[model samples]
Target: MEYSMLADIDTGEQSSQFLTFIMADEEYGVEILDVQEIRGWEPCTEIPNMPQYVKGGINLRGTIVPIVDLRQKFGFNNIKYITTTVVIVVKVLVEDKSKTMGLVVDAVSDVHTIAHSDINLPPQLGLDTGPRVIRGLVSIRDKMVVLLSSSLLLDLNQFQNIEQINEHKTQQPMATND
Candidate 1:
């Protein structure tokens, strides 16, 4: 289902709307409704025996939220601190319920109002990353921002695994509690 938004663009009678951000020199966007908040990078509690792309979890207002590093997910070389680093907290529907997750990006560019007509489907060829996550492409000031599907971006399989692990942990009799 394609959700459309209003934008203020030079194109007369047609406008573009998008929430744009930067990751590894490329701009990307997600529907505004899917976004919950933009937060500065914070230390995350590491989860053992998980994928490298999964950068552990963060405490958001007393709730534990998992974070994903787009750079690692997209096969970019790991680098030390960069000033542009930020975490975008997105609310995604998982298993019929809304769940919040943090996406680590290089930086946030701007929230653009992208017209529906301005978006172009990404080419099937030569895409290093699989196209399953990317919905389409849109131009913003000579740069193309890949529009990402929040549902696909926040696949809950890993989280489900984490939940299983936690369930086992809880099932085990706690030395202190017992």
Candidate 2:
């Protein structure tokens, strides 16, 4: 379903709405404004020589949206894509350009309005996964939600490479084995 039309009417000065989802039993959230749509699990056209976390790309309308498996991206084992599996289509900004991609998650949770004060900055632990992807940590209904920075989640350098490869593939004709 298209979540693009969902308006952010939260007038609170220091609050924002986030669309939460589950992956490996952990709850994660992204700003609702960045969401384009929510889709059910669907097979995609697998691309060759891409990272393991990059599941592949799917044709959404006229655009070929790349899909990233969050579980694999987060160093988790591959699980079956059940009925609850969903793809959250999000728009991210990179170098002044807007890119659309889908994130494969276990299941979508809920949208919660979080006040600025409620979000706690993630600790500066000696870990690769830092503020680059995780924006902050918030608690909702006693559950901790890792707020994510969608733009940073898809690394700019890596994403540009994917786009370049996609463009090159489209411009070149397929080779025949005859």
Candidate 3:
């Protein structure tokens, strides 16, 4: 189910709803407005010569939506896909274009409303995982929620590959008897 995403943080407004999901021991969230749907994990058509994190692409209706494994994306070991494994469909922005993709997560959690004041900036660690990817840190029910920045969800080059794959799929000829 989709919940309301965070409002403009710069404004320091009232509490905003966020959809939370579990990844290992940590909980992460994203704007609910950007979410398309939540679905059970399904096998996808593996693409050659793509990043390991890019699990593959799935046909959503008629659109080719790329699937991303967040565990692998965050440099984690491949775990067994269980009944809880699910794919969260989300729309992300890249270079003024909105692209739809599926994020393979362990399982989804509860939704909570957090005020802008509660969010704290993530500490700079000088690591390859840039701080820009994270929006901020917030505490709820004695747990810390790491908010993600949808704008920087994936690398620009990855989006290009996904777009190309989509175009290539659409350009293929349909088989029929004349």
Candidate 4:
């Protein structure tokens, strides 16, 4: 399921839906179907021996999910969090299977419907955040929002580790009352 952002845009209902979010001062969007829910920033239990981009896992609705700091993943200068900090839960498909993961962003923005015509290949000009991850751009309230590919936002190896952890937990036997 992990795919680098590409330029092609297909038509139909699947073409326009997106969930917008902010990181630092820039705006970005991911397909709405990929998003699970928006949550306020919560303390994450640090996991030893994991990538720095992996901010660790947090208990979400009684389920543990790994959180990733998009700011760091995009190579932006760190900034202090305010009340606006939020975690976006996205369902990512890996090896043809779906899995949930958390993305930390500065804030959540309005959802937008970007038509196929509005999407274009990212400019050849180099960008600080790396142009490879940008699928296209759309104008939102006089501000340009970069549309991102859901697959590129995550790392496959890390996701696999999350799946393994979940599997291990499930395999453990429960205590008997008797």
Record all residue pairs in model 3 with backbone atoms less than 3 Å apart, i.e. clashing.
Answer: 5-32
What's the lDDT of the predicted structure labeled candidate 3? 0.84
- For each candidate, what TM-score against the reference? 0.79, 0.84, 0.88, 0.82
The C-alpha stretches of model 1 lying farther than 4 A from their native spots are: 1-16, 126-131, 164-178
lDDT of 2 at 87: 98
lDDT of each candidate versus the true structure: 0.76, 0.86, 0.84, 0.79
For candidate 2, lDDT tens digit of each residue in 1-178?
5443333365534677899999999999999999999999999988677788889899888567889999998899899999999999999988888999999999999998787778999888787754378889998989889998898766765677678766876888879999
* lDDT for each residue of candidate 1 in 1-178, tens digit (9 for 90 to 100): 7534553445454554557887777788887778889988877888786789889887678556788898898788776646768888988777887777888988888877766677798788865664288879887788778998877774677767656655675688757954
Top-scoring candidate (lDDT): 2
Worst 10 residues of 4 by lDDT: 4-13
Using TM-score, give the best candidate's number.
3
Which should have the higher lDDT, number 1 or number 3? 3
Tell me how far the alpha carbon of residue 46 in candidate 4 is from the true structure, in angstroms, after superposition: 1.7
Off by over 4 Å in 4: 1-14, 125-132
Predictions ranked by lDDT, top down? Answer: 2, 3, 4, 1
Candidate 1 residue 125 C-alpha distance from true site, Å: 2.7
lDDT of 3 by residue, 108-152 (tens): 997777787888999888878643878899988898899887667
- Give the 10-residue window scoring lowest on summed lDDT in candidate 2: 3-12
